[model samples]
Target: MADIGGVNSFRSFARSWRRAASFAEVIPRRPSFVLAPEGEAVDDSSDWDMDDGRSHIDGSSEHSTAHSRQHLLRGPSLQSQGSEAIAAEFSDGASDALLGGSPSTRSSIFDVPPHLAAADVIGSHSIRYGTINSVRYRSRPSVNHDSPWGVHDEQIDPEAAAMTFGEDNPILVKEVKQGDKVVLTVEGQSTLPQSVFNSINAIIGVGLLSLPLAFKMSGWIIGLFILTLTAAVTAHTGKLLGKCMDYDPSIVTYSDLAYVAFGTRARIIVSALFTLELIAACVALVILFSDSLSSLLAGFATATSWKCICAALVLVLNMIPLRWLSYTSILGIFSTFCIVCIVIIDGLVKKDAPGSLWEPARTHLFPSNWMSVPLAYGLMASPWGAHSIFPSIYRDMRHPHKWERAVNTTFSFSYALDTCLAVVGVLMFGDGIKDAITSNILRMSDYPESLTVVMCIFITIIPLTKIPLNARPLITTADVVCGVHREHAHGADAAAQPSALVHGVRALIRVVVVLVLLGISILFPAFDSVCAFLGAALITLISIILPISFYLKLYHKEITTRERVLSWFLLVIFSILGLVGTIWTFLPKQLVAA
Candidate 1:
């Protein structure tokens, strides 16, 4: 009831404890330790405060006590008492007790027992044990900044904190003792289903549109095998990222884990890959929008006008803050579902209209060379694809360990739909499937007006849905590189917000990135090569290489010989896939075909 558990309240309680002790020497608080229940000690961190990143207990207790009055009982030498209890109340429950209703509330300062200063916290780095009336506490930080992967104490449940220590009953809410470890199981932010949906939204991207092309190029048997295999490997890599996160619970990004495993260089490489992929995605999205729109309204607007319109749309979309854009992922689910419907419709239309879709193009079961394999890989992987967002999605999930399920679920659902579309397109139109299956629908179908409208919706909404989701990674990368953390601003702590200048710079960066991508998209209106290149190069690198690197590097002892050999084999194989695929994609069509 006294708000004694708060950081400020703890300071006041400590000050009052010193004052009540009639101490002549005032010790200024300077990062004192919190006394463990059975003599173990732990450092007091800033996690005590809900929003602020500042620690509550600062300055020496001696200095704080010098200015205080002693609230002491004249009767007993409490040193004679064998056992003492220190009630550590929770901030969540303390207000009710402090409101003067709970029988357990200390009515007077003297209600606190003697030997309240039992802790060894009189000096630097030593915790002072205390027999307090009632003090509140919060969970500690998940990991240390320097040794992020080290075994550290994690915050336990408030209910669990109520249990007493052994041999001596003291401390109401349980605090972490030396060597005590707990996995943080934070909940109530997002539901499991929403997390699954989010994972799906993140993993499913523009790649789905071109899956049929992958099947067309790689042969239906090989293409289907590669797609399924890619999904399994992608899911495996996603789980690897999850395992990396387990080393440090505070790690919220892939780069953070990279820093943990390989230090600064790895982090920078991950960041660079992340930024480039997002930028590439931005360029692809712009080109996709312009190309699709230009195709739809061929006579209505010029190609330049379509490019301008697409650019303007992206500019407007990026204006929305990164957090609010999550709904777009949900919208992406709808768009993806619509595209699936369109794929099925395209197959059905083929039965009635035969060659009514548009001018026919030849279908091929194989590209002229094995190098063309990267084309399919690029279509599916797209320069590493959405694995970058896996950590963010996992961090939001209710059960962190269940991330594997989410990953597998996302891959399964997305691949099933994609496979259906891909197979349908490849079967109906054979190798005539365009880079985007939607193109097949447009150029190869002679459906009714209703079908056209549905097809248009599929085309328009799918890209629009993809825009914000794809741009999210780029916006986030910019925010990080630009030296600002606006996400903290929206939280309970205002001080965590960056300055106006930083926000301005972030906005400027976002603007320049969009403009550059627009220019690039306009310059190279056909983005198929860019997509293929990114998929062949970075997708192979990220999806195959990086995960293997992390696992083989970080978990050498945990993994076995067979696992190691397989990992190395994959590394060599995918590295070849990436290199050959990239070179194959950039070659002239005649050379590539021959």
Candidate 2:
């Protein structure tokens, strides 16, 4: 036999074993190279076929020199050294070919950096880090640039290429943008019915009180046309505003929509408008409160004292947490019902009572001239000033996609009732109607003082209730712009509770906001003056321009030519209305009267 136990035979076996071990390849624990699964074999067929498809390769490698032939044959055995002594099986001539890389990769093996070469080991079962042909890998044939035709080649992110998606997964993919996948979770989202009613209440606010005056300023023929037209147009605007939110689900306020449509300048302009509107609204509220309570008390309290009392009441009322406001909105429904009853009843009473308390009935079919058209046009736009909060209502619905239904329902009810009130009040009282239909009732009434006080209280409460609803959006938009809102948003990963300091700071901000508004109310107590300023500027922007611009920018291609023409027409018309109203705002009270 072959010298079974002799020292010389033993020494020869040892030499051959050491030679195999010297070139044995294995996976090494390195940071850059991902590890293959334990005990999994390297895929030999999928990787470098001595034909890794990069650079020049002629199929005539079959007729290549002995050196190339040796390389092609030895590459597999050298690469297949997963857990076995594979390199040993490769011949010494083949070993030289294998170590020298491929005809396509390079002729030299020393191309591996000195630092990398120093770290390289074989037979340790450590993963090899090198390129063969065009393929590069860590542990196994995780990447395969090799092609059956020896044609195309591409590199993958190594971490990506290393993923073995497993037998269950046929491919791998990743997101292009991460935040696009994040979902929004608005707290206190209303059920469909509640949301609809909340929208109704929001849409049918103090603006309805002015429509009869609009009917007087514009002719009844023009007034009715403009009134219905404004409703239809603004409702469409509300729809456009809602659709813009689809561009980004993260939008939570009206100003945010502005931010997305334009940029920082637009955002700041919108924020400034909202802030301005809120301050004006609070001023209106103070004026309303003082007027209502003074009307209630008659000789008992001064207007200034009534304003102070109303301010105190407002401060207390606003302190009620937002969570409770949803329930308070039901109170708004009652307020609407009572005000409607009061209007109808007071009209009946005025018709029956002595005409001495009312104005001499001289109703104008058209304006004495055209200066009044600005106020009339502005009045039509003003009723739908609820556009700012429309998105908030839509967002807080359970099925937000059906928001248009809620909007339509709101406008339908508000319009029907407002039209009734405007036509009836103007016709019954004639030119006797005050800017507020209720003012007619207050003036013409020979009613019980108890009824007058009750009417005053209801009038006061209606405007008072509106302040917080308006202020919330302003506060929310401020938070968003200032970067406090994102932190405040209660994400799934958010902290369980805010720190006490955070709560205190938030409370302080709310106080500061309310105090600033209170100061504005005190300084500019002329409610009509404030209304004219905002009606000209802020209301026109929210009700007309912003919505028109958003729809045109986002979906101009989708809109029909006719629709686009009509939209542009309205945009131009409203732009002019906004300008005229702005000029009208600066006119003397005498000029407005003219």
Candidate 3:
């Protein structure tokens, strides 16, 4: 009876120990070990959980039990099979903690191994053990083992750990890096806007306005040319718009569009043509101002001195910031006001000058009427020179569908303005409107000098405002050409910088081109002849030929039915009208004088 009781007691203790160790292994607090009593050698039996209902020993013999009891008197060593099992349990607990599980409950009975728990395991000494309880006991290192007592190692809470390691690891970092690179590239570059393109178009418009005035052609013939010019320009612009849309729309600029259409050689040709046109226009403006001043101040000042002063004044005005205003604004405010004044003066004059308003009608059958044809032709051609504006306007429009509306509005408004001016000028000047009506408006005896002065000022402002617009295409062409060289010699970043070097080079090119143009103007001061030649050559080339050529080049194979019909019409009309105008303008006086 005594022996059986002792066995049952030992079995109960072992069962309790196994249960505690198993729980500790899973929960994972710290490293654990088993110890024997004071002086006995270590037993060889492996420590394990058993499933028997009764806690009494079943596998071991009586001799083995005695040996295990005797071994309990000595301190534990890991060499024993039972000690290995205990070490494994503790190791399991430590691994669980590292993998983010809670500390094991069994760790409360035997503290974790010091070596395993130390923060700097790579450099720290291994843990040692000392017994306390009669059963065997070990002290646990405090949870704050890495720091001083009462000083906690800041635990990474579940929420923060999950956010940092789980959520934002690779995905967020990649996204942030990409965003940063894009912003840096965009910030480093400068882009030109649609407004700049619109100004270029307005400059072209000024040049075209003089076309009809210079080509002694019929209104119907001029109208045909205008229609052909419009169709060609529209087709060309549509093709460019298509190209721009093909790439990323953001990458397309006016300069890029021009380069895409005409290539590098075309840029040079266009630049030269633009320079010549501007200089001729400027000279015409200067002469018109000089002549007006000579006539207005004839009694008070010498014609030569007045002309010099007026020329100097115009030069000074051209140099000022007023040159930067939009062409539409300048014309709308000054030119429109002048036209209104001319109409008012003409209306008032008709009351007293009785038959003068009909004078133009009488001369309609005369040879002088042929002069009006050229003048009207030049005037009509002016509005058609608005090709460069297409890119600007196209970009501004919200959608391609809006293009027709915007273009039609602009053209219709321009045509109305031109037609009204022509009719009013012919009626007001009668036989005397030989020169530009604005110029001869002051000479009309029935009109007040104040009105004429206003008219002169208004007309003067139109040409003055156009200087910057005229200079832009040349500047842009030079910029693109030089920019290419700079990009190759330096890097893209260096070339992109709008520094003193870029501005200086651009300015130098402008000065050189303008000087060459000024030389041409001096050699050919006849406004009528310059306007005629320019109208016949550049206006036809830009408005008629270039558009057709570009459209065919860009979309010949893909043209729709409407586009095909329009293209054919443009080709035929432009060829016929351009050829006739060229031939007529070049004919000798003896051939047509009869």
Q: Model 2: runs farther than 4 Å from truth?
A: 1-192, 247-253, 353-360, 398-401, 448-450, 472-515
Report the C-alpha lDDT of model 3 over 18-99, residue by residue, as the tens digit: 2211110000111211221111222212321222111112232232223222222222342123544545644663442311
Candidate 1 Cα RMSD (Å): 17.4
Clash numbers, per candidate: 34, 10, 29
Candidate 3 lDDT at 202 equals 49
Q: Write the per-residue lDDT of candidate 2 for residues 1-594, one digit (tens) a residue.
A: 445655335433332222111111111111111122222222333332322211122343222222322333233334445534433332332343311334332221111111122212312223222222333333333322332223222223433332321101111111111121111122223555656655665566666666777787787778888888778988888888777655443344564455445533564566566667666666766676676566556798987787777656666766665434434544555775677777666556553533222432556767665677677666666667777666655654545667788778888988998898777667666665565666666654475566666777677766567666556655544443333432211123233565677566666666666677767767766545455556667787877788888777655556799989988998898788788877876677578872
Q: Which has the higher lDDT value, candidate number 1 or candidate number 3?
A: 1
Q: After superposition, how far is residue 507 of candidate 3 from its true place, in Å?
A: 8.2
Per-candidate TM vs. native?
Answer: 0.65, 0.61, 0.53
Cα lDDT of model 1 by residue, 1-594, tens digit: 555655335343332222111111012111111222321223323233212211111232222122111211111222223233222312221233211332122121112221232122211121123322122344443534422223343343323232221111122212221122221111212345556655665566666667767776787556767777777777788888777655433344455445445544565577567666766666776666666666666688876677677667767777764334544445655766776776676556554433323432345555535655667776766622666656655654545657777777777887787777767666666655566666655553365657656766655665565565466556554554444524211113323546779878887877776677778777766566777777887777766688778777656666789989988988888788778878877687566541
**How far does residue 515 in candidate 1 sit from its true spot (Å)?**
0.9
The TM-score of candidate 1 is: 0.65
The number of the candidate with the highest TM-score is: 1
For model 2, state the Cα shift of residue 408 in Å: 2.3
CA lDDT scores, all candidates in order: 0.52, 0.53, 0.39
